[model samples]
Target chain A: MALMIAVSLPLLAALLCWIRPFRAVAWGITVACLTLSFAAAVFIASRILANGIAIGIPRWFEADGLSILVILLVSFVCTLAAIFAGGYMHHGSQQTARLWWFYCNYNLLAFALIVVPAFASPNLVWVGVELITLFAILLVGFENTPTALEAAWKYAILTLMGAPISLLGFFVLYWAYHMSGGGTLETWQGLYASASTMSPNLLKFSFLLVFVGFGAKVGLAPMHTWLPDAHSQAPTPICAVLSGIKTTVPLYAILRLLSVILASPEARIGNWMVVIGLFSVGIAAFLLLQVRDYKRMFAYSTVEHMGIILTAAGFATSGGEWGAVAQLMNHSITKSLCFYTAGAVLVVLGTRQIREVRGLFRLSPFAGGALLLCSLAIAGAPPFPIFLSEFSILSAGLRSGHNAAVIVLAILIVLAFIAIFLQVNRMLFGNPEPQSTPASVPGSVRTAILIAAAPVVVLGVYIPGPVHSLMTLAAQQLGGH
Target chain B: MASAQTQLIEGLNALDAGLILLTAFAMVATRQVQGVMRFFIVQSVFLAISAFLIGFNRGSIHLLALGVITIGAKAVAIPLVLKRTLPDDLYERREINQVINIPSSLLLALLLAIAAEFLVGPLVSASTDPVVHVNLPIGLAGILIGAYSLVARREAIPQLVGILAMENGAFFAGVAIAPDLPLIAELAIAIDVILIAVVIGVLTRDITRTVGTTEAATMSELKEEPYIWR
Candidate 1:
């Protein structure tokens, strides 16, 4: 089955990465396997588009429209990330074995991300989120520096605290299902269809708990303390995944539940999301002005993007839903593309502190140029999909009569843009610090950036037919009015 | 329908829940780092016992497997890691480095238990059995107390324990409400717990070595750093 192939190939690649016999060709073999998994994911996405949801082996695997979208995005980004990994690791390749370990864990993370959406079981999905965090924590501390260790600690501790909160929600939902559904546990789709008949109080409680719990993983505000530390300290390719795709699993969990809760006449998840979404944006805006690390800036931008998607969800309009879906992909591509550039700068310059490194253009013109272009795209400039989708998001908010939210969102977006470009300009154009970063960058790194960048450029003006349908189906799955 | 077997099983369930609740109180009352670690093992034992009791009553093999894994990892393996991580010298130095006094923490734990009781009131009221009613609130209390300590305690190790306590509490609650939750889910949770403890152990060792202390506030500056962006 396509589902079986999609999930197992990554773990198999991980095994290959861990073994010594494949060390010489390990990176090549890993990328080849990931490409195959990517192929499998594309097959699944195409099937979901052509036919309908694919329920594999009952409870073990299922791919709905939304899941198909997530899987496609994750597979594409992860494959590109693996390419980035090969280049980034070789650049910093002091120990080959350690680099091999990175591949193993990277594959494991991809497997977990793949598993998350494939399952209908909330518990299995929870396991998927937990596994992603567990695997990522190791990568975050891969360098074993004090900062890396600290970041790993915070990530593990915070995820530990947050997951139990989510578990509480899962338990509450199960108990409610036990009482109401004739002792049969509900799949996510089943729960969505049966929302109206479930106990209102329990459903509401679970909604809030699930939101907060998963919100921690999604890097939503008040619980976003771990995100910047983890992202900035993590190796660049892993940072790309964390910002680009790892964060999606939690939001995906939330979005899957959102349709169910909203079907209830008294569901309050929408209003709650609006409040949290706005707060995340506002807080991230103020915090963006203070980011000194380039990767950390991108990490904070992720918080802003997630806020945008969450707020768009609250609009409860088809336009909003489509914009949310589009923005998720747009942010994934733009953000990962940006991290690739940041990784280039990090490997060459050897410091993540923005003020400490400069004149990237003097050292490596291609990387510096790519960094500038990615920044422009990420900051929501014209001709980029971010700008288009953000425009739709603002329109959706205004149409929904959320005037205050619209105004706040507009101001925050502009503020973030100003802050990001200001910092990037200083780094890009200024004099090289004496004893500066490496003069040359890797070809593979440039290739990965270009590959990621191409989609950003095209999707800005025109989306491919399949991708368009995928987003439409995803929006419809959310049941946005 | 009030068979002696039903009464005995119900009584055992109550004891299981009670032991977990008692461990929460003991966790709060003790400031000795080692004492808290010991309490966790005891709490985990009761948790496994409760899982076995429920599994025995329900005739579910999955719950029995959950019980075995719970004891193996949580009670035995996790505590071993915790004990190994803290240095012999810091045993006294790490003594109850909480932000609040012991009495206040105990009081807060009490208030948290009451809040948990109120929160679970609706679900408990809806329950068909009295033991089920008792099981949930106690689990909820265990969770709240664990969360309270993680915040109230100043040291990183206790906070780790606090997190473990929260997991135990939630697991305790899950046994009561979500017995039908697939075994894979429970196994996933167990695997995550051990992996997390190991990872955190590595981090704690490094933190203590570099910073020369394990207090969380000392390293809390990662987020709260003063803005220098002109």
Candidate 2:
């Protein structure tokens, strides 16, 4: 019941917001829906912990450790973004009607995110992911500027192209299942159970299809061209959602498919993920250097972080898998915080070009210090959750005989650290321009940022007992013992 | 679980598979966006027919539902939507700017057909229905051509059509091989694809209105450069 509510409340809210007469009414509906969705998700997680239900709705939906973790993360991120977006756009130049439309699509997008982790069928899962792409396309172009439109176009074309490929993967998998005697291999759990007997060739091909297809959404390298444009062009709160929950949901799908295919005794899925993850990280490291827009730089950082998570998951060791889950949580929180500050800075300075702005510290201590803190936090500096998660990944890689992968990851992490901080440093400490006087920052925006950033600080030193077990259970769910 | 009517089902699928493959080639051969859309509509009609025939032969209500939705959504609904999205002057100059000309693309399509044939070899032999051995390759070839057109065509309209063609191809193979796959899954996909089409149509209309052209290559300003140099 909680699972169903968690998924449907946002969808219902989308409709209510879309048709509501007054903007205030729409905002109230939106807030009500997000709060309910978050509460439902937490309740579902609690039930799973206490009673240990099998967590399925006949054949349609299922949740396990993996779904629980991602659901919590997705719900939490959307709530934060909803809270922050209200403040960020409240002061914007857009009219009330357009803002209502934005709220409608935003909730629809959240609905898609929640839908994905709950599916038991691969077809339904693919549909969920495609819905994410569709809703995200609308969100990306909400501003309707030429740049925003272009980003939307690129996002639509590139990611939609990846979908057909994923469908082919499903075709191959379904065909394989039917060929192997149908009933026992129909669902995701069934497929995993029977994976060893399935045609290895088809499984291998589907893995590639599923990987690249879902990887397009996850912002893996070569398929990541749309990430920066879409993230930078969309309104900032939407950017946080794009970089935060939108990307991670698809990665969850990829991981689900990966879990089944990895049982085939060929190490291709793990090895290929390592190679792709490393390449993404390496490429993003260099691109981070060339980025002139602060938002765009942070977008590239997403590609890098995705690579890190993918590389960790690819290791398929308990430690590595645990790290992947931890990193996923930490990155979503930390990156959203970074984007919140970046959005605030964009609001204050009236530009996203790093070269145009100067002396953020002198102009506004709160915004400047946030810029400094967020940059340091996202750069994987010590005493941040990112650092701890990354350390876990490196140690796991080393322990698993992925020596070269660990080395490559370490080098890229260092290079990325230097590249990212240099950009952050220039904007925060450069000579103050006359226009650099702080614009009035919203109280709600500041509150949202602090709420998001607090976890990065605390989780660095300690993960609460429930959350630690949650990550471990999630890791086990993906790469079962 | 083998149905007695399986042989009749197989016969119909083989004929439809060849027709589907021909439409894929026709899509590649055509230059005009309207002509491409026609090929898509024809191809989808055949897909619905294929599903209907499968449903009748097997007497499975789910397959019948799949066929109905495929026709309603993909054949009747989506093409109408696409036709409405055509910019007023675009049809007069609808010839797709070629990254690779039609002749080269045709040759490439043939090669993809051959590649798909070989690729489907292992799975085809394992299928209980021989129709799949024939149908799966046709579907894969269509997917390949659709992918090719996406890259080769310069216009936004044709690229969108190309994506549809690829989707049709995937749906073809899926129906051919796993006709028993759930109805609700196909329904969800149909609704999602429609939503996607509607959204894409809105965006394309806006692009045409704002940029004065729907050529994808020209919308290049959103990069990390200091300026777009327009």
All candidates: CA RMSD (Å): 2.6, 2.6
How high is the TM-score of chain B in model 1? 0.91
In the predicted model 1, the residue pairs found to clash are none
Q: Give the distance in Å from residue B226's predicted Cα in candidate 1 to where it truly belongs.
A: 2.7
Chain A TM per prediction: 0.97, 0.97
Write the residue-wise lDDT of candidate 2 on B76-99 in tens digits: 888777668756676565777778
lDDT of each: 0.84, 0.84
* lDDT for A376 (candidate 1): 91
iRMSD, model 1, in Å: 2.4
Candidate number achieving the greatest TM-score relative to the actual structure = 2
Candidate 2 chain A: worst-modelled 10 consecutive residues by lDDT: A178-187
Candidate 1: list runs displaced more than 4 Å.
A93-97, A433-438, B1-8, B56-62, B80-96, B154-156, B205-213, B227-230
Per-residue lDDT of model 1, residues B65-166, tens digit only: 999999999988887776687566655545767788988888888899999999889767878876668778898898889989988887777888898899
Candidate 1 docking category?
medium
DockQ of 1: 0.54
